[model samples]
Target: MNVEHGVHDAPYFVPSPSRWPIVGAVALFFFALGAALTVNKVAAGWYSLAGGLAILFWMLFGWFGDVIRESQQQQYGQQVDWSLRWGMSWFIFSEVMFFAAFFGALFYARSIAIPELGGDTLTRQLLWPDSQAAWPGNSAPTSTSYTPMGALGIPAINTAILLTSGATLTWAHWGLVRGRRLQLICGLVATIYLAALFLALQAYEYHHGFLDLNLTLASGAYGATFYLLTGFHGLHVFVGTLMLCVMLARASQGHFSEKQHFGFEAAAWYWHFVDVVWLLLFVVVYWL
Candidate 1:
């Protein structure tokens, strides 16, 4: 544990040169390109997208495998651990900013654009003379029926599920710290189930919106923002659930220790962040 010691106790650990980063970049490029092309109705785009995802997943598996091996070998000391913590923190901060951009868009559209388009003063009278100034706004130039989503239904239930999952995740962390293997496993399993259930309910909500409610992206600005925010949050929940699954798998293999489980802590941080973002979304997008 000495800060200035040799290989076994070095404070810093530098990894060997990696091909994974370059590979990941390539995979991402293909994936983005494919997605764009698919959006434009290109037929071959699916193949490229699938291929890219496969490659990306393979790269992640290999990269994580190497890191896990190093972790098990105890190659990382306190300084290296600190570095990991800092790295994960910054990553989460970046994710926060990413969500902030979308939330800002929602705010701007609601507070400024909608008002300017609907107010009686100048622009609305001149441009959209027949439009109503509402949160969902006009469905389109053709005026399709629009029903705005409220916080009282599926959104409320999903919010509760996420909050509960956050609690379960915390309980699992406590179990990990206390070395109660059964408690930790049960907590993680419960969290994962909650996450999956939340996703299922969200999908059902989307189905209801599209079929019964007619809330499509093309429905109006409200539909766009609602889907944009909630859809991305659902994707985050999927990712967080996957991360928890990995953590649970590692826990089963006895990979984490009470003092040195940054992996679990990082996943927990991300899950909690997702939960908080959902709460905000529930208020702003669904309730407000």
Candidate 2:
């Protein structure tokens, strides 16, 4: 291997300064303690969860702000950049596995459990009526049968919005490549807006589910699975949106150039992954 990749991004060595970690740790302690207590509400579980969340956010702001400053000051080395990439890649991989587990559970429930429980003929006949194991709208009792959302309605619109945002982000990337700062800024703005819009539409859809269709997490096995799949995906979307906002902030500050925009690349990868997951959920959980 090449002995060195030029003058790396970060400094060779610096003073071990700052007590951020200790403060972050203390903040986390409050957050965790608050969360645990808040769970018991009357015992303060709710307050604990709230306080912990606040502390967690505080830590993130201070911690990431410090890293951003270091990165911007050119204290980061190519090695540091590579490390960030690998860490993000591994995190995304873990997220994939997490979703895979949920999807697997969904598949088993739809394909195996429901079918076996509602089968007919001989012993099957003793099970229930000659029922077919359906995905959402299974032939189970009304109380347990869960109906998926319609694909053409809000979900399809959300999908389109996300895709369009992805395209805009690509344009922003190109603008960065060509060093068109103003155009890049516009692209980032558009992407962020589109992401926010997608989130709003999803919220609306969830409201419709609860108020109009009476479908909810408490509906039974079907309801439970539906929420488990869609809820987590929605949370991911929210997270991806925040990442895009960060990229936008960095872009506006002229942090990236055509050659050193891996941060943007990683965020885009995550957003695209979020989009793909939503599609799968729409089809398997909604349309299917």
Candidate 3:
């Protein structure tokens, strides 16, 4: 039996003896241990969490860099591209399901739990009469106070910025397909810069929310869920921005050409996906 990178005809040229799996598993183990201990007031848990985060970040950097290097070497074929596209599609699908769960939870809280708890129902009248039934941003239960992040201000500006970045990335993809190296490089650079700006602005927004608006994750269930969802999405945006930045770096190094540029395409796909998701999030989570 022919064996290449542990299996013949495997997706992409996964280098032999990949260590990311072991690294990831060990990091996860530490993360769990730290989480458990932290909940129990153990002093060493914070150190464990820090170590796990460091290891996880290191693993991601190394593993993704290796993949980027391999792709630039043109060891991947059409079959490999197909496999990658499929993988991305499925990954996005899983993300959709993840967000769907949160949306479902939101619906349950607003449509059922809150109303019932506020004595809108026959059985809950005696239990939680002091609670208020309201949508998250407008008004929430009495447990916490927070201001809703509206879409008319910075959120709208961020939407425009992300949309523009998406457009520039599309232009870059066009340049790649048409064999315009300068155009491709310019477009990639613009997109990367915009992404960075978006992240910086987001951080500023978070600071404003905390310092001025008193919006915090610990404020209430609304604040908790809002931060959990938007915070995770922001983390993804940060990651996507980093991916684009690396693509820009590779573009500058003349690593990708018109004919062979799957790495560029993959980053574009991921960024576009992030932009679309942000649009929805802005409308649903921030605006409405």
Candidate 4:
């Protein structure tokens, strides 16, 4: 533990250099390339994508294992903890901006593009003479039927599930802080169960929308925005569920203490964020 002028100095833990970042980056490159190729129907793309996903999963497992070991060793001091907090905070902020972009696109398409297309004579003459630029607007170049999804069905149920999950997560956090291991474990299990249920119901809803209701990515502007927003949010929920599972495993292993457990805290924060985002999605994408 190196210290500068003894009075003002504190031990700052700098982890030894690791190869995980580079490995992860390379894996992501392959994943992206393979995904693009798959979308274009290139040969071997599926295999390439599967391989890349396997490598990425390996990298995450190794990297997270190392971190857990370091935490167990108490290698991280308050300084390191503060650094981790700041890092997670910034990462979450970046995620917020990421979702904001898609929301903005939805806004633009609804408030500006759809209205203009419906109102302007030139657009009507050139593109859709008989189409009305109403929401879930009939802007598709082809004649594919579409039905807008209502907020009163599976979406409403999912909202209730997310809200309940958030409450259970808070209960788990309380247990963690109070050193009640059983309560913490139970709460986490409940949260995970709820998340799985949410995902299942959402998948069912998507199926209903696509296959039964004739709502699809190509239905019109509404279809495009609808799927884009819900799809990305669903992905976030999936990632958050994985994080919660990891936290649950660590909690069961006695890896977290009352005063120190940023791993769990970070996961909880992310889950709460996912919950908040879904609420917003319900209001804007589904209700409005």
> How does each model score on lDDT?
0.89, 0.78, 0.79, 0.90
Model 3 regions more than 4 Å off: 1-15, 137-145
Candidate 4: RMSD over Cα atoms?
1.9
Cα shift from native, residue 122, model 2 (Å)? 10
In candidate 4, what are the lDDT values of residues 136-232, reduced to their tens digit? 6566668387779999989999999999999999999999999999999999999999999999999999999988988988877788889999999
**Residue clash pairs of candidate 4:** none
Cα lDDT tens digits, model 3, 1-288, are 112443445544545678998999999999889999999999999999989999999999999888877777677866677788899889878877887888777667667777766656764566555566666642343555667667687888889999999999999888878878788889988888888888888888889888887788766666666777778788888888888888878888888877787778777777888898888778777877
Give each model a TM-score: 0.93, 0.86, 0.85, 0.94
lDDT of 4 at 273: 92
Indicate whether candidate 1 or candidate 2 has the larger TM-score: 1
**What's the number of clashes in each of the models?**
0, 17, 0, 0
* lDDT pick, better of 2 and 4: 4
Candidate 2 local lDDT, 159-216, one digit each (tens): 8898898889889888989999888889989988998898888889989988888788
Off by over 4 Å in 1: 1-10, 139-143
Ranking by lDDT: 4, 1, 3, 2
- Misplaced by over 4 Å in model 4 are 1-9
Q: Find the candidate with the highest lDDT and give its number.
A: 4
> What value of lDDT does candidate 3 attain over all alpha carbons?
0.79
Best by TM-score: 4
